[model samples]
Target chain A: MMSMHTKNINTHLVEIKDYFKVAISVDCVIFGFNDDELKVLLIESDLKEFKGKWSLLGDIVRPDEELDEAAYRVLKERTGLDDVYMEQVQTFGAIHRHPAGRVITVAYYSLVNIEHVELKLHNNELHWHSVKDLHEMAFDHKQILDTCHERLKQQVLVQPIGFNLLPRKFSLRELQNLYEAILDMELDRRNFRKKFLSMDLLMDLNEEEEDVPHRPAKLYKFNFDKYDQRKKRYLGIGF
Target chain B: MMSMHTKNINTHLVEIKDYFKVAISVDCVIFGFNDDELKVLLIESDLKEFKGKWSLLGDIVRPDEELDEAAYRVLKERTGLDDVYMEQVQTFGAIHRHPAGRVITVAYYSLVNIEHVELKLHNNELHWHSVKDLHEMAFDHKQILDTCHERLKQQVLVQPIGFNLLPRKFSLRELQNLYEAILDMELDRRNFRKKFLSMDLLMDLNEEEEDVPHRPAKLYKFNFDKYDQRKKRYLGIGF
Candidate 1:
């Protein structure tokens, strides 16, 4: 049996309005990769407090929607794409973080192939800014972006999340480039290629680079779909 | 310049009342170790909706306090201890998850030594329930408990968080037993000893077991205070 150390709530009909309620929102850190740079999708804020500063795509959470659903809705409304890979990173709640009021937002980071986005169909105010170049941001967006970037950097080392930010068919050079961009470091090319080859996570596409200034490199596709199907058969035993 | 894809928010003073807002609270799963079983501190729910159900110790977060301060306040109120090790695992915001009207509570788990709790000073309603035998709980607390337990398990593998749950001086056998309890698996004695010894995380206190039925094992204390002090000197260089 459990016991408590606090007073009971007086749930009166009129007292409901007297209770302290807060407005919750969800922020999406949409990350993409292109031209050897990692980028995040951002929009201009209309709020007068942070004029001219870019803000992450976000909106107030409706009472009927789940937190994850609210995040997905924000993503779809901005990107016009479904079936995105998203992870909820953390929740930001500070009394004065929002100038409008005490609005706490759950932050989520998503990885998407840059080519999948059709810019013409999206709003003109939306733009993809290089993650390395962002300095000033509306609200605490820069902190949120940095938190998600650290998570992505750690995940890429142990998981295959980097594939989501790349083309279906890519060369070993391209994959290494993606890693370098995410980590912001120059990894030893020989050791990196050898490590990937030993893991056997890629399929030989039997294709070559279409055009290049130097000799064209061979291309291969991530061999995950088949492995993922096999893993789907594995069961997680609970305690 | 940043752009918007959705209509601007109409922040009318009267419209503010019409905006959807939810009450936010914090629930703490206080974990204590004693009698070779993992236990969680729970309180009896006086609410008629969940009669006889055990609930986690929690309270509605204040408007002025940060989310972390609310959790620490709960821990201090219940166990009469400060500076506890607590981590916020995730926030649960499913519709109707709380029987109360639209309350989304952030769940945090705290590790405490059982001896640290002076039950006399605390309310009589508080009791420690064995985590392994718990099946039903008030609200969605069972889900919250499992989530925090999963986080604790993962943290033990890479971090020294488990030291918070054990006594200051312990034998190697006692240390292994604590690890086994948290992980719920048997580790080879030889390998476990070798692994911990290689890390040099424990200080040889030059002590011996005093009261024991059989031969006594060497007693050692976690050498973390020194290591932690050294780590504090190191800085995190950001990109």
Candidate 2:
């Protein structure tokens, strides 16, 4: 499966290579979750300028590709995954941002159910590290990561995008903890429970946590259909 | 004065032009204010490909220049004005968004304080039609304008950017009219006034509307110092 996908991708690259000079590239901020911490995917820079340094998953713009397509292509090339929940965040363009010369990058953020993508073939050096422990990254990547992190925190409050980062069946306690990690604030458990329940967007999956010695809690799946309907009337006015 | 400013601007442009392709282009959402009605700026296209059509003012980026500086240069070149309040909004590049080849455009919106701009310089072709009355514009200008208009409406609620579109001294009623026009909703006059007063970002000028025959309203200017402080706090929210 991986070899066939790689061959298919190489074909697309050949087609793009023969077309017009592409001026746009997409950089992804793939956030993952584990051990009650928020983490992001990173790779060691293979370029001579930044060898041995960690960098965001990125690539050059293909001659005939749309910016978003390039972002998806780079993601697939590096991680061998598709259909992840992604959104365009911002474009960063300081004249001297790139050592290769003037390359403006469009940044995107994606949330993946980490367990689903853990088996994918990625760059040999690719790894996920806790956002809290991230250090200097190659080619302005640290700035890009910071910007994406800010957007993630803001979006989590107003959108149900956080679900994309978690398993389909999750305990309310686990969900609350995810929020605390992303927001970096200790939410009052009782108040947080009250607010989320009142929204009525969660479905009681009738499933409970397993393999734990302590008492397991009930699990829920986000009811996306109702969320969409409510979203139509949503004015983006809430936190 | 015009020659001196132009010379200074040229020097500044020259210093950065080597690092970038400085293409002067304009992305104007000509906003119209008619009887409390809001609108945008547009132009009739001259290209055979999109002849007889309206579109946003835009063109190729020149060699070596800052994106924001280029945006203003394009605005000034097309409108014969400087010192206008313009902002870099977004960069649009959906491969098929432009039919005239793969041109990546950085979008910008300018608030002209309509009364200050004569509008006689656009070869008598530029139009400021109502936002409600707008039809199909050339290229992807309609989409660009819609995006900028949305940003403008959001900013109005949180920032004092509306002042850039109003006269130097404006009445509270006129200010409310501008908001109602852009937001497409009627606001309770008393409540709107109360909100503005509480913000304390406006300075009463001890002057009144001069030309109206009926009872005149007092004038006020936006307080820049207070605005600067509020702006710093507003930027902290991670917009």
Candidate 3:
């Protein structure tokens, strides 16, 4: 009886060869933050079906590679940066999402500072489109982009991940601008400052912003040591 | 030039047919709360490699089906329940996580009232293991279980999702017990009740618990109307 069951299982595995072979791709929504606006990297689709339309930077997952490895590869190949913040947000496997045969793409959101961008576009092309003013994209990418952006908005509220988009030292105004860009809402300036201050996770660098038209605002650095001490209680953080 | 590029793209698509094919599976971590303990519905693994081991309720996703539809199908097939609250937590695609082939599984965490479980074991086996007392699971499911539990813990704090694990009417103690079970912490009785009342998302049933050994506690029902009215600001809710 056990052998019969084993044979049935083996037969089922063989059946997977014909019915379950799906092409898996990884599309990365690489979010970069400039001074006040949030941007996502895109490339013009070369496929005639999506000609002239922008699409996310993506590639087919290699047979031997892990899903995260595929996402990191896309990030490195496009941005030429290795130590960027990357997270797998969701998987998009709608039957008709891909124009080609059944391709299930895993969507990931990555954060990188716009200042350190070194595009390795070589032959292909890349552009950083501001997320607020995005045009229609190809192959359900606009939906993917929106989903990732929503995740980013929620993530920035609970975690200190937004720091990945900013430089080492930043003014309180710059931090508020980053939050506003991601949240897409105007926050009361004083309240935002008070809330962030109450977290007690910032260091008084005793510095000020340079190259600004108005009087420079005081600059402070995110205190990683304090945040590391209180890592698991990140849920208490909210706007 | 356009024809040459189109040919190159077609060649690449065919290459995907050969190499990028992978099997996709959806594993449901069905969490249930009964009285005090949090439990998860698990099934005995039929695969020989995982002989005598427990695994999540899951199946290979069909080619023509959407990912979410596949998850709903699994839940309906296993528990005989529909309209359950489910959320996709993450996708696990470690190259050799599956013994047979490169099968990348998406992990979804779902909440179901234990009273409603109608397991269709069908000559196989099923068990409801306490989340805290779970033994080693097959594949990377143990890690997946832990990750889902963490997400559930955070989710319960920031949303009114824990009510799904309970009956339509429950006591403050029962509610606190459910929270303690998911969060794995001993919440102060008064503070827990006070925090919940402050949310103003519960309706007093004007009744009390019956058939209990100790003093009966007042029962209340979750106010879905208020929650529906305030859906987007779920983040503001936290312990």
lDDT of 3 at A67: 90
Q: Work out the iRMS of candidate 2.
A: 16.2
Looking at candidate 3, what is the lDDT of residue B45? 72
Q: What lDDT score is found at residue B167 in candidate 3?
A: 93
Residue pairs in clash, model 1: A2-B43, A2-B44, A3-B43, A3-B44, A3-B125, A125-B3
List residue ranges in candidate 2 displaced over 4 A. Answer: A1-22, A119-121, A205-207, A212-215, A231-239, B1-35, B79-87, B96-100, B118-121, B188-210, B213-239
Error of 1 at B226 (Å): 5.7
Would you list the clashing residue pairs of candidate 3?
Answer: none
Find the 10 residues in a row with the least total lDDT in model 1 chain A.
Answer: A230-239
Maximum-TM-score candidate: 3
lDDT of 1 by residue, B1-239 (tens): 23333643311112344444687778899998887778899887766777778888877777898989988887887688878898887888888876667777788999999988865324426799988889998888899898888778766765678878888888888878877777777778897888788767789888888989879888888877666665432111111
Superposed Cα deviation of residue B208, candidate 1 (Å): 2.6
Residues A154-234 of candidate 3 have per-residue lDDT tens digits of 788778899999998999999989988999988888988888888888899988888899999899999888777774653
Name model 3 segments beyond 4 Å from true. A1-14, A122-124, A234-239, B1-14, B234-239
Q: Write the per-residue lDDT of candidate 2 for residues A78-191, one digit (tens) a residue.
A: 556778988877776666666555667778888887787753334436788899898898777889899899878867865788989899898889888898888877777887
Q: Which lDDT tens digits does candidate 1 get at residues A57-173? A: 887777788999988887887787678889888788888888767777788999989899865324426899999999999899999899999878866865678889999999999
Fnat per model, in the order shown: 0.23, 0.07, 0.34
Q: Global CA lDDT of candidate 2, please?
A: 0.67
